[model samples]
Target: MLFNSYSFLFAFLPLLLVSWRLAQGYGPTGLALVLLAFSTVFYGLWGLPFLIMLAVILGMNYAFALALAAPEPEQAQPAATTEAGSEGEAEAQAKTESACMCGSRKQGGCRFRLSRKSLLGVALVLNLLPLLWFKYSAFLAQNLAALLHVQWHFTSPGLPLGISFYTFIQIAWLVSVYRGQVTPQGFTRHALFSACFPYVISGPIVRYEQMGQQFDALSPITAENLAKGFTLFTIGMVKKVLLADSIALYADSVFNAAEKAFPLSGGEAWLGSLCYTFQLYFDFSGYTDMAVGLALMLGLKLPENFDSPYKSTGIVDFWRRWHITLSSWLRDFLYIPLGGNRQGRFMQYRNLFLTMLIGGAWHGAGWTFIVWGALHGSMLSINHFFRACIKGKTLERILALAPLRLCSILFTFFCINLCWVVFRALTIEGAGRMYKAMFAGPFTREAAGLSATTDGLAGFAAMVARWLPNNYIQGWIPFALLLVSFFVVWALPNSHEVLHGRRDGSHPRLGWRPTAAWATGLAVMAFLTLILVSRKATFLYFQF
Candidate 1:
């Protein structure tokens, strides 16, 4: 199901493009049908049961909306002389509140507006049902078993592919429908919007209204968009195939064999941990880039997800830079709903903690993830407290001084790396052991795994170990390359600058030099792909 796989990239994408473009010649309806068929095939690849579940939910939502939009019986008024002003006021109030879509409008005032309360009830239940089933079924079952003292064993059927994404898309759609933002684009557009294969598994979470415009627009693909699209697509492929995947191997080797992965000195463990952190960023973000790039090629502009987050000085700054779409989604849908900053101080903190806790839970069904989220939420809370105490004074003064900035940056990286232990660990116990080992002792040669005593485990130690021999030197080379790659990504220009209309963007003007640079980037990417072809790796985010 990964977009990077040979089956998806070479087989599925090509087949879909040909069929879709061919069908588009017929009309919008034909195109919609083609997309729906392909999307179903893509989803059905996960399992037939998932497809059935999806269909049932889609049907339920569609039916519920129709029912909500059905006309309500008029309330009988008492036979009393009403003032002219009162009658006019009632008419204006009705107009203000009633915005609905049911059947076709007639010459007189149409009765289409639904009870908002009823619509809300159906939307929340229908939209959240799948999320609860897929994400928390095991957790819920465990709690229920404990409560009832039942002997029933609960085993989780693995999640439906892209359930997280499709769930979010459906919820957003239903909310928009309830809010009178989306006119019914009919069934086909709704289906396509919910299950667009390119972005369903991992997403920029393309909104309902956004896709509606694209579905209805008569504009043909322009050369300018095509060029930008192809450029983005090529760059994304390079990032995923070459850079991200390459770094991941070293990260895996080290983390997987934590206790025995050489004599992991404090320095070595820190280096390895940081490497994994960066590896995850690139791996997940690279997949997102490819998704956005692919969508763009199809004339859809999926939102950007990351900036140069590593460059951020604070946790708040890091969150803003990383996973831009998800953070924004959580803010808009969850945080704001919980009162946001408009509420008093205690409530604001409550909302912040709850938002992050839920956000963490959204990532996975584990206490470790909850801890990871709590760590971030705590950092944010402390930062907020400091801001209030500091008044308008800048932390910039401290950061402007070289020592303070370096110390804080290094501390921040270490803190984030420590959190990754929880984020990456196989279990809570594994994380606890890793933490204990870090402070347990000084550098030693006792710890051993593959390439354990290779002497090139730590970069500084590895540099010193370079004069040792063949296997040791060879292993160190890959590690060295990984180190260099981290620095490159860490120092890379801000992707957000290019994504937004910021003056200082990562991409230069699209002149001949820039075009040549892109070509070089493509070549580097192809070489990376060749390296990775021998070892297929799943993207890190697929678990989420």
Candidate 2:
């Protein structure tokens, strides 16, 4: 059920859209049910066993949510877009120490004798069990065994697709339920939030409250929504199919070679790593555009995930701009819960470090991810410390200077790219190999043609082998694309900007409209993307 797959493009999505439109006439419930049913089918197609796992996980969470639910305490409104801004109340008093969701809200007929805090603790443990068993058990056991000097080996199961995202999203929902900030909407709403197909596989990783309302008062399907949806979807498809996948040829070639301990010329290493940097951004953010566009077609809005992250001037800024959903989730769930910045500067740095370490581990069962996380956590702590040391007008003036700002952006990009090398590598050793090559590998033909030596496989890399006619041409394409990626990322308005964009955050860029010209352009782009659908490449984040 990949958004880029032929069956999904021609059959499933179109059929779902028609069905969804017809169902909308019946009311929101009809729309929700149709979506939920199709979403169920979508996940099932990935693997029925995982679908069962998802269903069980969803059932348990819904039950826990209901158990945790008490009458919604009076509040202004469930936090909206500003959820990102205020997620970390690390200032304190946020975590309900004694009162759990169900403990005090409905004292009558309380099923559990446990207090709210205890119930939440238990529920949280239960909620994380599947994720732990599915994703981390082997890694944790292997480490524990090594630490204890034992010959113990642990076998782990295949990670269910979207479990990381599902776990995080539900944790947010469950926590919100426990916080008594939101009432349990219903079973269908619960399913819809957790299982809606758009964000189901690869997500911007939305929260419960963020989407609850979108499914409730879903506006009737309209032509304007359709136009915007198609336009955005087409743009995103171009990014993924035309750019990201194409760029992956270089990324995969370089990294795969490094993993096998092959000698990488400095140019090969950087070409691959930088290509990957752009590839990942375009892949995930491109997926975000398609996800948001799809939801919009159904009159739902997904939170924005990226905003020109490569343009970030600092590590903290990079985190804020990149993977915005996961960053907020970490702030709310991990950092704040660890006392955030409440205790003191020392504790704040400690919390930030620990939050990133966990965030990194969430990506995969490899030391590469932990190191990646640790590097980021350390950088973040340093970033915060520097901010703490710098003060008012001096800092402002330094920031205002164009030259210094450019240096800052470049410095930040360099650090991020280095970290991404660790993140993308298959192992810590492989990462070291990449770093060695990036820093000081031979630049000669003896390196055996960067990508050619890697094992036989057909992918974008294979496509590249055919598309690139000569060795010289092969080397130049990535550099050229990198230049274009840099320009697109730093100069042009992003998809959001193109729609409701301000290029400099103050001036409007050209935007889409419900006109024939826009419609025709989108149609042509869609047709081109459809031609690439036969490749059936999965989005990179789908593995996470």
Candidate 3:
């Protein structure tokens, strides 16, 4: 069941919370078992076969963790602390990256009996094998068939829910064992680490090094945490149910038109693109908020996945902010493993391109996803090159100017918008159609389907009229919500910032509390979101 579903919000979470609280007195193992059991139930609800797949993978990964190395108190540390490098990549950052990819077999990693390196390789493959089979086997086979100029077909059993997410989480765990960044915990804890109900489906991906201790020491479900967690969940529910889903109508229409080879006016293409741009943020951001919030209620903290990515001034800056966990995973496990910025600038650029190409492919098994990754990879390489050319103080001065900073932010956002069109497309040809409409379409007022209005509000109204009937008063909702989203993303403090309060002078009074007013506001949002749960609209990132 989805976290936003009626069964989850009204039944599962309440029962789990009560059981978790009661089990706390029974000790850590008992409490952990309660969570693991609930997590199994939650995932098993999806399908028994998939749950079996998860269980088998978790069992194998845990065995690998135990086999690699027992927990060494002296060696254990957060994986992020393990000499993950940076120099020209000052803008690149992540919450948890791997150190296992470092060190050669001969010169380093001498601490092995029964060929630990070989075992680690086996474990990594074991984790990846299912993912490759279920998610990409058909994509791979089809491509191979095309290359051989023969008719060949491969049938896929379809993707298991959260297979991609849990695969990465488990890979990070097994590697952490090799790196001695974490001691393998008990089987129950290891299973629960990746299968935690709140984040199991869509994640701000957690690492064992960080979450291991939290699993062992789950804090009690207190009123303070309850208030905060529920407050955040309510906020996220509204964002997904109300804003993201509402705006998706506009985006879906335009994208559907483009996919069918329908010629769109420039205004229609841009309007669709912009709507989806906002929709993606609100959807993912909303899910992140809900995941973090729910985990908090269980007294386990998941790292922040986003930090106002829309405001990023450079591609590098955007990576650091958006999908913080996955980027960090790619950085530590993939990027650095391939020799990050350690080599000269050219190798760094090559690594950046390869890293992003792989990153894009990680999203899906389509050529369109590969193109998305390639675009970001290219952008990242160029961003690094530009930064390298400018000296320290000169770069600082350039960044310090408000006008340049604003321009940088706008430019980065614009580039991201173009790339997102490809990211959202059904196929390469469809993306080209949208791109043509966006860039190469006629500029004349009549030709481009202009409203001839300079007023921003009027323009949005006119834009909506193209797809929506003028007499449909409700047609204005998406545009109205999109305008509200602008204020929310750029101006308002995020869920984290609201809970923690801003570091800057602004929003001095923005902290969340258990006061009556806060409860009332959250109650209203929850009620509204609950009523709209009939849509059963899955979070967008769930597909990835």
Candidate 4:
């Protein structure tokens, strides 16, 4: 059920769009149900067992929300009126009315709020249980067995697709309900929010408070929105099929060779790592564009996930741009609750470290991810410390220098590239091997004993034996493509700018407009994407 797949492009999406439009005539509730039913079918495509698990989780959360939203019985004498006689009584009555208006309870008010808080806590744990069991149980068990020196055996449960994303969404929803930030919707609307297929697999992680009103106000499909969505989807398809997948060939070759204990020359190591860095960026960001486009087609607006992260001048800036939604989610739900920056500097650093550590582990059940998270966390702490050293006038003067800014950007990108090696490796040992080769191994072919290698068809056999090494591409073709990707990422406007027809915030660039010429271009991109879709590569974030 990948959005890039033929069945989704030619069959599921077309049929679903048609059915959704027709259902709009039946009114909002009917349209919502149609979406919910379609989302159910989409989820079921992954597996019935996981679908059933999702349904149960949704039902429990809905029930908990209903309990949280239940109204209390009115007092017999009406406390406000009864206490209106004396001045002190009137003051107390005013406070009571204020509390009620603010959606809080006073004395003799609903006991349901207390009970609901407990229920919400239980619901959060219950929802996370499936994610823990499926995603992390094997890692935990194996580690425990090694520590205890036991020969215990355990079979891993199949991971449900999008469990990490949906689980976070559900947790956010439950917390919002408990905090009275979100108004409870009917089962149909809630179900649609929980299972919306566009972002279910790889998400921008939309919050209920942000999107609830959009869900309620279902506008009729318009030509403008449809065109915008199609354009975004086309652009995303080109990024994924044409760019990301192509780079993945070189990256996979080198990494897979390393995994098989092959010694890599320094050139091969760096080439592979750089290829992977761009591959991951385009892969995840490209998927996000497609998701946002799909939601737009259905008349829903999702939050932007990326903002030219590579242009960031520091680790802190990088986090702000890369995976914007997830970073915000972690800040609001995890960091803020743990006292955030309101606490002392030491505590703030501690919170930052812990948040990233957990965030890394959430990506997958591996120590490599943990170390990757720790590296970023440490860099962020150091960044903050460095900022503190040049505060006020000095900071402003330093930032005004363009060369310094460029150097910072380059340094930050290099640090990020090193982290990606850890993130992409199959194991920590593989990561070590790759890093050793990247930093210390010989760079020249003569030094590495490959100076006699031939060119053209004659060399194909040797290159094939070396896992079809990246050098097989010949000439400047690969470098040309890499240059093109850099131009698109750093020089060209992003998808958001193109959609909005103007620069939005820090994204200062030109945008696309509806025109006959643009339509023809989109059609060609679509055709090229279709030709490449036969390769059927899954989006990178799908593993999480």
lDDT of each: 0.68, 0.81, 0.82, 0.82
Q: Estimate each model's TM-score.
A: 0.80, 0.85, 0.86, 0.87
* Ranking of all candidate structures by their TM-score, best first: 4, 3, 2, 1
lDDT (tens digit, per residue) of candidate 2 on 405-462: 8999999999999999999998888899988766542432233244545554444454
> TM-score for model 1?
0.80
**TM-score, predicted candidate 2 vs. hidden true structure:** 0.85
Per-residue error for 249 in candidate 2, Å, reads: 1.0
RMSD of each: 6.8, 10.4, 10.3, 6.5
Spell out the clash pairs found in candidate 2: 100-116, 497-501
Alpha-carbon lDDT of model 1: 0.68
- Given candidate 1, what's the lDDT at residue 469? 29
lDDT of 2 at 469: 28
Off by over 4 Å in 2: 71-112, 144-154, 441-475, 503-507
Looking at candidate 1, the ten consecutive residues that score lowest on lDDT are 465-474
**The 10-residue segment with the lowest total lDDT in model 3:** 88-97
lDDT string, candidate 3, 284-382, tens digits: 989999988988887778898988899998999999999999999999999999999998999999999999999999899899999999999999999
Ranking by lDDT: 4, 3, 2, 1
Error of 4 at 94 (Å): 27
**Candidate 4 accuracy as TM-score:** 0.87
